[model samples]
Target: MDRSKYTILVADDEELLRWSIKEIVSRKGYRVVVAANGREALEVYHRDHPDLSLLDIQMPELTGMEVLKQIMAEEPQALVVMISAYGQVERAVAACRLGAQDFVCKPFDNDDLLRRIERILEPVRLRHQVEGLLADQRQRYAIDQIVGQSESLREVFTLIRKVAATPNTTVLITGESGTGKDLVAKVIHHQSARAEQPMVEINCAAIPEHLLESELFGHEKGSFTGAGERKLGLVERANGGTLFLDEVGDMALDLQAKLLRLLENRTIRRVGGVDDLGVDLRVIAATNRDLSKRVEEGAFRADLYYRLNVLPIRLPALRERHGDAPLLVRFFLDRLNREMGKQVRTIGEDALACLSAYAWPGNVRELKNVIERAHILADGERIEVSDLPAEVRGGGAGGAPAGVATATAFGLPEQGIDLEEVERRLLTDALARTQGNQTQAAALLRLGRDALRYRMKKFGMLE
Candidate 1:
């Protein structure tokens, strides 16, 4: 926006000519620095790193051609316009071959000079803007190198673009454990309008029933026993940003009423505080639970359910996303080798078959852990079936065979089958593995803690 702030370096041997050029460009809202010779121009160029450079062809120590070559070598895309006297047309032509943008003859019209400079700089300015935009986009979508080439991931990409454009809407993401729901939430927050603000997450089932309320809506000083000082709740701290409720279904019935009130009123009253404080935040709630079933069973509040389910997004389970298993396994293997400083390369055909054949009950998280375990214990570049955990390698009651049968047996199937029964078993297994740690269970299951709770209710398997 500040055109005058853009720096330009003018290099010419004649002091009068340099002064004239500097004055002309400076008047047109550009900062100008003058150098008496090419040697001095290179020094000033290094010091200032000016946006554009104007070099006189003939100089004392270093000729304009020499400076142009050095500058181009340093930055292949350096923007430099060569200047020559009336009879040095041949020299100017030679400068162009050496990466000079355009040649300006001596005693040239100032208007033509200005027009030429603008013409030369326009493309650079456009490229810089485009690159900045692309960098921002990459930062927004990237999630720790969780690469994907499947149609399922492509659909997720489309959903991300749509959701990012409307940051304020409440999003409900449903998926089996290990399906990357948290990763999706992070991508949405990173790309949203409130990216600069904080993203506060609360595990609804992690906190005790009595403490969950205070965790969400802070207690006032002296409001409760041992409430020594005033505290800000997760919702209040996430003001003007995003609040990710990971296990909303685990929230006590009393707290659910309060949460609904806050979502509706957009305000909170800290414990013992009288006045309500307003907040502006986007709510992204995830659960492995079936909210509709919970509502039907009179478990979760219907009003709150509808309020949170503004835009629904269901992530595909790993087993359902055909052909992505091998890609994921390789990605995890590469990550494992880099972190552990190993040279492990390929998964043996037997190992690859076993991986592809086994149901990834743990989802991506389980898959990653399995690969890490294998890489650490593997004897060579290729991991054999022996490297895998016994349960996964055996492919039996310990672990179901790969694909639909295994996914169903592990209760990871999201739809088409007995969806409720599948989710119920899945959440139950995740909870058992984590030893009732809803947070860890959610991580293992790749569902939000809240999502796991919903699934529990749908299957009547609440912990």
Candidate 2:
């Protein structure tokens, strides 16, 4: 809207027409640069880097179409409007195809010309605004946001740095449901060459099987009963960027084959379309499911597994990264304070110890949620143990009764007992209490099912 900051370049073979256009636009407070031909237009464009250009279809030294092509080659995003006589409308349309923003006829009114210019500049202005917002987000979600000082987390940070620098390596991120797999995928994309482009995401397990294919590979109009218009699939939209497939292990076998084909050939055909369209994008697939076990069970394709496992990055569960809970608690507390408009600056040491001692079934996401809840409930400047969740404060499975001596259920001896034997007994008791349901047992133990399974296997309790 501030025209004084923008400059316009006007190029035409007729000196009178060039001066007339410059005078009309300059009256609106924009600085005007005049050129007699296409060659001079390019010279002025390269020198001044004007925001917009108006060129006549007929010019000396170089034709307007030739100049448009050269300008686009130099600056793909440059805004240019072509001018033509009534008979040269066809040529003007050709200029539009070569990246001209819009065109005005020779008999065009000054008001009409200015309106067209404003319309063209509006989109450019909005795009720049969106780019600024995205830049801020890129900074916020940088790899440093994956907070932890433990060796396991440090190793994950190292792997992310190494893989993010690569251009097209397919990355498979394996972790528990809430272990920040999505965050890892985003960091890789924002750090890659395709950061400027959109990173399209499709949750393979979230959508129904019947619609998932159509969503991934768009359909043409009339391709299906309800499809009324042609659709661009996520693969096509992510052509120059990255496509993140979350919960990919739950994808159907038939869809897995098609996805494998896309990975192998970099081409996809819509469900009812005949033509195969080529797409170039980096693929990052994530899942909490044990894909290798699924393959062994014939539920998942082995070939597809191998393709996706090329650059596997397995995230460590929260419990595996010991001593990191207090760090995460502080980080979340500080963030929640600002977000929730609370004055709670620090957490009591007893509350911090309770949080660190409890097994986090839902990982960092759950920790953040707990901190937010506590921030809202805290009546004083610091979070106390009373502000924590009942399960955490009570230190029992789903907040067992205070009178129940769950910690001493096995009745430890005066002498120290075997830690592994005690853990094995606890795991067995949790399983028995849950009627052999691993999910419920994991909940009772406040552990992720994957973590619980690992311990079960270690104790020879898994069949």
Candidate 3:
């Protein structure tokens, strides 16, 4: 019969305990490596590169905590369960503090041990499945360009597919400024039947209210003083495609009525032309404002809001997408490296930690800008904490003056803290827990190995 394959490492001073763990794990369709001392454990760990480890806390030549530290330094996400005696609970807690995934007493029950292992491995397995799907979507539809591996982004991807395929739907995408609302609109349009046709985008807030109507509906020559010839409006151009109205909440109240009419009747009259032109278009609108509040205050039209909000997609802010920061950072790093002709290959773990913990109110667009700035400032192939923008490295002192309340509300790090140092501590702890395995470290950090490495060097962890 075929069996699932997993590799495990067992390190203990006593041969009996080592053998016990080895036997237990091996019986579960895993290949096992046994080490009698800390030095041997490190050697086996490096040589075997096991998927999981069972480490004894007390060992000759090196303490389990010391071994754990070294393992974490190398592979921040390595899955290692620590073993300690009942009296040595302090050591077990210390191991946890240092980043051990789990701990068990020396007189451990085999079933309980198996259960702990299962709990740790289950998420890893599920994460892998999710990553596999993301990778496939990236290749199949260029979805990877969006650049996030977080569960939140996965849900977003799922929702995009569902909402985009629905015919004749009006989708209102709401998010803070620079959260990639336009990109989401494009992805939806690309996935829909309108892929072959044009996707016309209009920024309602940017355009003057007087000119908006003329832009939406084509104007005939002599209709306006400056009108030179008969021109097709965006609504007419997007007849068989999609029209993305950005900052829809900012549109003038009167124009909202016209938009509502067009959505309901699927027809438009040019600014000066009398004939009504029939259209078959899909509307996908986005706004940074709270339309509901606007409606209550009479700042926005309620009927128009209802018409555009048949489907709503709210994007998660960068802070809410907890584990995606590092992934996106790596992507930006690679992109900047190529564009700038720089060989910057790594970021210190601490620097990455800074980015992960900091609340990016500006979201993905801000992250990209920060990375580009860091790339330009980097003096070597690696990006250092120093390379980060002064605003970020200064712990929000120089940047926009959003107070601690804002940070607390959005789950950002405290203002004026050493972001790089905080990142370093988090990365160090995660690595120590995982026992120096890069792949596991990535999983713990919710990043890819390349991302982890880039950050590791940026924080001055590299030789």
Best candidate, TM-score-wise? 2
TM-score of each: 0.59, 0.70, 0.56
lDDT of 3 by residue, 1-463 (tens): 1114567788898877788787887788777888898999999998988878888899999888899999999989888889999999998998998889999997889999988887888777776676676555444455456778776678788888897778578899998788789988888877776776778999998998899999998899999898989999999898888899999999999889889999889988898888888999899999988899899999898889999989888886676565788888888888777887888898987677667655566879998998898888888887777777655654543332223223343355556677787678868887889877654565555554566777899987756
At residue 37, give the lDDT of candidate 1: 83
Report the C-alpha lDDT of model 1 over 1-463, residue by residue, as the tens digit. 3457478899999989999999999999888988888889999999999888999989989998899999999988888999999899998998898888899999999999999888887876787776676567558556545467776677877887799789889898887778888888888887788786789998887888898888888989999999999999999899999999986766777778888888899988888889898999999998888788789988899999999888988787775566788988888877787888998999888778777766577788888888888898888888988888876776443454444343434544455477666567777787888778776676565454556666777677663
| lDDT (Cα atoms) of all candidates against the true structure | 0.82, 0.87, 0.81
* Model 1 misplaced stretches (Cα beyond 4 Å): 1-146, 395-463
- Candidate 2, TM-score vs. the true structure? 0.70
- What candidate 3 gets wrong by more than 4 Å, as runs, is 1-141, 395-402, 405-463
Q: Candidate 2: list runs displaced more than 4 Å.
A: 1-120, 395-407, 412-463
Worst 10 residues of 2 by lDDT: 396-405
